[model samples]
Target: MEGYKKIIKKLLFFNEPKKMERFVLKETSSKENRTEDSAENNAEKDKQYRARRRKEPGGIRKIDRGTDESSKKEKEIQKEDENKRKDSEVSVYLSHNLTSMKRLYNIPMNGDVVIREFDIILKDRAVGAFIIFFDGMTDRKVINNNILQPLMMLSSLEIKKAEEDIAEYIKKQILPHNQMKEFTSYRKIMDEVNFGGCAIFVDGIAKAFTGDVKGWEHRGVERPNTELVIRGPQEGFTETIRTNTALIRKRLKDEDLICQNFEIGERSNTPCSMMYIKDIANESLVEEVAKRLKSLKVDYLSDSGELEQFIEDSSFLPAPQIIATERPDRVATALTEGRVAVIMHGSPFVLIMPITAEDMVKSPEDNYVRFPYGNLFRLIRYFGIALSLLLPGLYIAITNYHQEMIPTDLLFSIEAAREMVPFPSVIEILIMEIAFELIREAGIRIPGPIGPTLGIIGALILGQAAVAANIVSPVLIIIVAVTGIGSFAAPNFSLAFSFRILRFAFIIIGAMAGFLGITTGLFIYGMWLVSAKSFGVPFLVPFGPKTANAFTDSILRAPIWKQERRPDYLNPKDDRRQAPISRGWMDNGSKGEDEDEQ
Candidate 1:
């Protein structure tokens, strides 16, 4: 009835009509008036402020007492807050600890955090206890058989330490987990729980028990996707950081090998493992790496790639100062050389630091193969890098400006090929380079076997189409193709990327002033790279500074037995890696003595 009356009244004459805003298109005089008034007031205030500043001693106004008091009070409040938070130990009260767990983890909302409450049969009576873990992260069988079953059936386990500390009792006898620890700090227990471990809290105990039962789903050890080698171990580093550390340990069983765990990132609290031979690696270098990592103010570190950027020497440098490899053998090689490897949680790629430019061209496969084969491959890889970086520039320069450099027959053939092309040499090369890069990137982005297939087929079809259209010369297509293949041959992915990016710059300079411009760019680029450092080691170590045994293990691989000493630049504690004349049969008893005498 009220709705009908309202509708009828609206149809007749609405009482709210006067309240409705009626549009009156008039000049906004009030806004103009207000602007004038505000301008005058602001001018007065500015004049007064300037006069006050001039009157003040040394143009400095006295601090406000009220603000000072407020600041002091704020400091006191923060100090009090700190004092309150300093007691981060696990509480003896079960309800308080349970409430804290709920508040911290947002219980009832977070479905992944599983909290199971049960009773443990003590010597005299049953004790209230609970275990907290992520559902998918923990191994159910381990928890059921090892943890819950043992604690619930504690009477059969024969607990003789009734008078002992409950936390120690639980750690020593109650829990049969291989890796168990009693953590008094609740934050540490939560951290362990976050990384796929279960935390056990007893009714009266002030410490929590952490079990290492991480069983998260991850890819198994397989051939490295990027750093694949034909003659070396097929196993690659997985997303699991501990697995990576174990892989390194499996390769190297030296007693001095240390894998120290560090928690980085304020919010993410990522576990980073720094592995090195304590006796071989320079103390200062390890300290420097640790300092940089600890001082990082980032809230989250997702991968080693992101971390490499943060801790690296310079961001503007072209070549990568650090080596990021997925092969455990490579990491082990770096560690054996007195370098440090940082393995970030959830990332397969491990970062090996204090690398040199020569290190960029070397590969793990080199160590596995014979010296001759290694030397041959290293030479070819270097040549390929040079080709990838300089081929396009050289082509542009020779065709555009240095025509006489080419043999007469080749020059004539090149002229014949470009005669049908409407674009200049620069444009022709640029078209082919961009087209090749597009094809390569498309191949990578596309899935599985189809990717490689598309790259091959697409390049052939596109090159043929472009040549038919006379958009690019046939010679240029061959040049671009060769350049791409050279790039793919680079051992380090990061170094290859560095060359790819600089290729464009070389192209531009080569086009502008021919060989002179290219040479100048090279000089500047060399200086830029030479000035860069990787954790105090020069980018061109052993090459620029002429260190000992530089050539033996650098660009050209000497026989494994010949690399007797470590690289001089690292300043490692143990200078001699191996005895001279390392091959026992080759020693001949007197050969090494004779060489030593000489």
Candidate 2:
């Protein structure tokens, strides 16, 4: 230790051109440690100590001035004093050398030892102190009040002796009986304690004791705003990550369920939790998800949507690569099917990774309803989505480009309707489409009751007035209204938006080349749909690949018991979700009473 100290001292300050002078001073016997008994014997120790000074005092010396000794000796003493002061500052409880206290709790009065300082106070009639160590990561209240007050107000004088006394006092006087464990390590206390934990430091002890002090504002669980359901669990995930995880866990109680957490964002330190189930989930899938999450280097993430875009597999595709669901049961079901779920702090929605095109069409309510009814609704929704996308384009094409395909009576009616209007069919259709879109947009912006009413009134009044004034045909109004209704039938709003944009492209093609243009537009649209993928799975799975089981619930309705296996799109380990012979039907078990009597 002595040799190491000498080396440190020499390396820090004593190295210089005058090696001979430094050696003469340090090697000399004047600077050796002295015994306490010998120090008492020499009454004029200070004067004797200064007699060997190198730079002799010229005149009367001031109290602060050092006696003319070797400059190295004076500097060495000054350095030692400064170091001693720094050590004192760092040690929190100098007088109390408590054995239980960890090294981290030490708050030195000395500059080098003191890690941080915090003000102590009382709150809700409990003694506490605020720990201000981490700049932004830790909550301030836990440090100041939870930790400091308990240590300061302890009745015992000897801190080492008061270990039990302090712990007991905190349980009895300061904290609730259940909170005793909170007055331990600062790390565990802060994390486990319901309230933010506080830490207090004594002078000599290197460790601080933390107590629970976490209580803050939070929102109550409510129905999901975006992913609304007509028939399903009403509860939605809150901003709290713990609450969100609990919501999922409540629905899924399997032992294999795993939730790994990480703190990202350099300054925000936002917590992100990844949820998956073992055995059922693919190991590679979980590893890939964790790797991607670890790779994220952002300052802050406000929502899961922001993270989704950053970590998604494909950026150019309009379809969402991740399935963001607000429903907890949905997340649990996904986990059961061996899919990974990513949940972000301060966001209600949980993101299901490696989603397929099939995910956009599926709903949480699908499992809730009977198979046949559910399948019917699914088919209807698919039809509605198609109508929403192609209705206007098809109408334009049939009326303007492929008039021969139209029925004779329908064509005459359409021509009669158009005769009253001066604008060309394309211009007339475009005008009505734009106006309807504006009305629909306006209705969404205003308050609910008024917004819908205004939209309805505007559409009806404008369409009627336009027809009366010969501005637009009544047939065009009908086409636009049906198109709007079809768009609303889509399950996913993001997918619906993609289809809406695609509608315009079809409309332009139809006007340019008539039947040839419409045929080419359909072909190109089909190709685009086939090419799109969500995650690694094909977006147009059941339709493009033509899998037998994939179409069990696709395009047409299938009976519930017959649809036993899970969709193959997800590559589930347990494909058969239902047992064979689940359908209940028994016919020949008993004889009739009359027949038996005879």
Per TM-score, the best of the predicted structures is 1
Candidate 1 TM-score, true structure as reference: 0.84
Clashes of each: 0, 50
Candidate 1 lowest-lDDT run of ten = 55-64
Per-residue lDDT of model 1, residues 111-158, tens digit only:
999999998776567778889999999899999999989888863344
Error of 1 at 139 (Å): 0.5
Cα-based lDDT at residue 302, candidate 2: 86
Model 2: ten consecutive residues of lowest lDDT: 55-64
Candidate 2, residues 1-598: lDDT per residue as tens digits? Answer: 9999998987889545755544453432244542343756454655655664343122212224444333344557655543333243222343332221223334342232213443323232332223333233344555445444444453333223434544444446654323434332433332332223334443323444444344456788899876777788989999888899999989988788899997667446667899988776767778888988898888877888888888887786666778888888888877876789998888888899776666788777777787867877888888888888778878887887678998999999989988978898888888888898889889989985999899989999998999999999888888888888998888777778777777787778878877688789778766876887655567677777766565666555467677677667767666776766565342122235446777
Runs in model 1 deviating more than 4 A are 1-87, 156-165, 588-598
lDDT of 2 at 63: 26
The TM-scores of all predictions, comma-separated, are 0.84, 0.67
The total number of steric clashes, by the backbone 3 Å criterion, in model 2 comes to 50
Off by over 4 Å in 2: 1-129, 132-214, 546-551, 555-563, 573-578, 581-598
